[model samples]
Target: MPTTRSALMVAATAAMLAGCAKPPEAPPPSSSAYRVYVTNEASGDMSVIDSATMNVIATVPLGKRPRGIHASPDGKTIYVALSGSPIAGPGMDESTLPPPDKSADGIGVFDVKQNKLVRVIHSGSDPENFDISKDGKRLYVSNEDVAGVSVLDLEHEKVIATLQTGEEPEGVRISPDGRWVFVTSEDAGTIAVVDTAANKVVNSFKVGRRPRSIAFLPDSATAWVNAENDGTVVLVDAVKHTVVDTVQLGERGVVKPMAVLLSPDASTLYVSTGRGKKVFILDVATRKVQASIEVGQRPWGIALSPDGKTLYSANGPSNDISVVDLATRQVSQKVKLTGSPWGVITLEQ
Candidate 1:
């Protein structure tokens, strides 16, 4: 009888200890557990798409010509470039269009939680594209019309410095090391390297004809930039600001590379060919084109899923985004968007 009672008490004590023990921690969320945000240039609004459903859940109104979109380091805020300059296509007469509205030219600050534009930062004249600092305290913006790069202080909400770059500066990228910011000038076909510490243009080097966008490797030692008019991607030595090699995408005048993005592992390079209507996948080691998938007309902006299993391309003329599955090298779906989809980015929810 005593042995039986002691066993029961021991079992009870074990149960009590088990109940008091801490539970196991929940696993981290997968990459798809997020939302996709796209900027529509023609509609002047941002489309919020649920990543899982791949449907447009909300449309947040922004100012005129919202193009470049990027999220803060914490993914709590979004910054979009709002331009009032009339759309002047290549060779178009700017004198025929309406006068630029200076008031609408600024960077739209958006609150992710509020799902609205909280404020507008007066970055500079004709703010087209920009890249935020690693600390999210500063923004390096490219003023296309002004032909300069403006360094804006997020804390003060003002432009601290504006350094003259090449003509028609459009693409702005900060190196992975956070030491230099690179701006691409389409007309000049050159890249202007800015020293982040000094906020000055330290070097300018020609890459190709009409360099459009740039993507840097994880180590920040190498960079890949697209030369639109040349129909090629130039491999650049990030440290020296010099071109090491050029990989011809296609015949000039037919294939115009617009945006370049590196894989998470930096093993593959993706190039979105504007007007070429296709996205080319290339092996970085061999610098050889592995495959090409026809996405849509004028695919300008490209982004990869967090897991690196999927790719999304913003088709400006088609008004849709191509969702590609990297494993099969095929487009799995096309998410339609209102107006011309100019830029695309994914953020964790």
Candidate 2:
């Protein structure tokens, strides 16, 4: 037996040693159930997919030329952009306008719980793409033909304001903090950063030719803009509001690129080549093309699952969505849909 002082010292040392030891290890990651929604522009319908089973659960009819799509933050509602007059945009002859389609030029609000379109809120002329604010109270709709961004009040279900932007704006994305909205001008080859609170274009930066879509990195410190005309992806620094670098994807003679999506981990970026029929997987840190997987004819719209394990590419001419497994970087499944698929969104329970 040790003396009282010696025993106390031993106990103190043991306590300190125990406190310095590492904690037990954490469990490995696992998969979770997810749902994928694809908007078929040709079919005028939406395809619902069970991500776990990789099967189509149901197909719901939507408005004409349904292109841009987004799910509510709480996953309660899915807003689909509907263009009644498909040929209303710039450079189009007014005489060519198809008989007015009542369902066009508005947002089809689908109640996710009910699995149906609950309401149609008129946004403006030719709503192409849209983004929801961080607080989920407002929606920014990029009306391509109208050359402006329409601010929709979700609670009021009405357009509160419309701010003029560049001609033929195609992509609209809200900043991570929901303070700014970035809209891409396909015809102008520029990006207009709008101040959400002020409802005005605050900054405009020149990017690659025909900038169509935009995606931000995980940190939101930088964003990437896909330039279809130049076949390059321009990286924009968020704080400085400038193009830091440009990554060329394909030769000008090859094909035009359409959409850009960043992996959930921010490790890789996926770009769909509209005329190339190939999806390019790029390493974010290295900015190198890691793999170029052949998808389908006229692959335009692209999306990734919430967990970042799967990728969905909408091939317009093929009229199907190619499901790519991120881990293996292979085409796991091809989900056939009605007409030309344009936009995709993933939902999780």
Candidate 3:
């Protein structure tokens, strides 16, 4: 009934409104294949590798310094810690590096099905590592530059708390029972225990020099922390939050333990030595060295396969992933990646 000119104007306005509206989210997948994700810190992208074929399937662009990577409890989403801080390795001069772009620091939320970054949650300053709650509502993130831990509420997408910690906090992990949140302070050489319910640090104890990573048993009775400078892994009494023992992997200064991962059965402990260029296998029951597999240069992040038959190490310097076959305790394949790979995680969907 309207004139052609008026009808065209209305149609154009409607189209503009439609373009401004938010796009609908991709529907959840009914089925998915197993894939390994690696975060490249230098190039600011994530590599998706097909587990069945042992080949890289896709590369998703993330942001600056994507270091820590973890999946949601439901395996629907992956959260990566992205930082704008300039890279300063051991013995490197920090003063020479450029200033940090504070705006680029946040936790990247990637939708597994879409293989894309859905959003970025504010995670305080310089988030290096983080762990999710059992129900997956909250994220305990280590604010490395601020020397504190930020508690981010996923539903509200806001930081609920910023708890204090020692200097240069890096590794973050929650106990299996979900009663405690553990954060490692690298420069302080200590672990801060946060009571989840109380939402505060209840205890802080020294493990050893330069502790960076933590692994817990299934029962949550004990935990193992890497003492990087000491070239040893320290066993902790998870309940008492006390150190029980230390297992030497190699000579100090050479064998710097970076990441600790436990087998599904909790029978074996796998440790990636940063500069040592090896993954040390230890017998959990006896706390003895079982074997040391040479992986690559600066193997920092390690993950066990879903079936528990293979291990993947993110070698930062080599810019590749070393696939270790657990049965042979040897490196079976090396998957090349662009940029410096910092963290690796496997998801079977």
**TM-scores vs. true structure, each candidate:** 0.90, 0.86, 0.90
Provide the overall lDDT of each model, using Cα atoms, as 2-decimal numbers.
Answer: 0.93, 0.85, 0.94
lDDT for each residue of candidate 2 in 71-115, tens digit (9 for 90 to 100): 988999999999876545335687776676655679989988788
lDDT of 3 by residue, 257-344 (tens): 9999999899999999988999999999999999999999899999988988999999988899999999998899999999999999
Minimal lDDT window, size 10, model 3: 25-34
Model 2 vs. true fold: TM: 0.86
Error of 1 at 132 (Å): 0.6
Task: Rate residue 29 of model 3 by lDDT.
Answer: 32
Error of 2 at 101 (Å): 3.8
Kindly provide the TM-score of model 1 when superposed on the true structure, using C-alpha atoms: 0.90
C-alpha positional error of residue 80 in candidate 1 after TM-score superposition, expressed in Å: 0.3
Span of ten consecutive residues with least summed lDDT in model 1: 24-33
Give candidate 3 misplaced runs (Cα > 4 Å).
Answer: 1-33
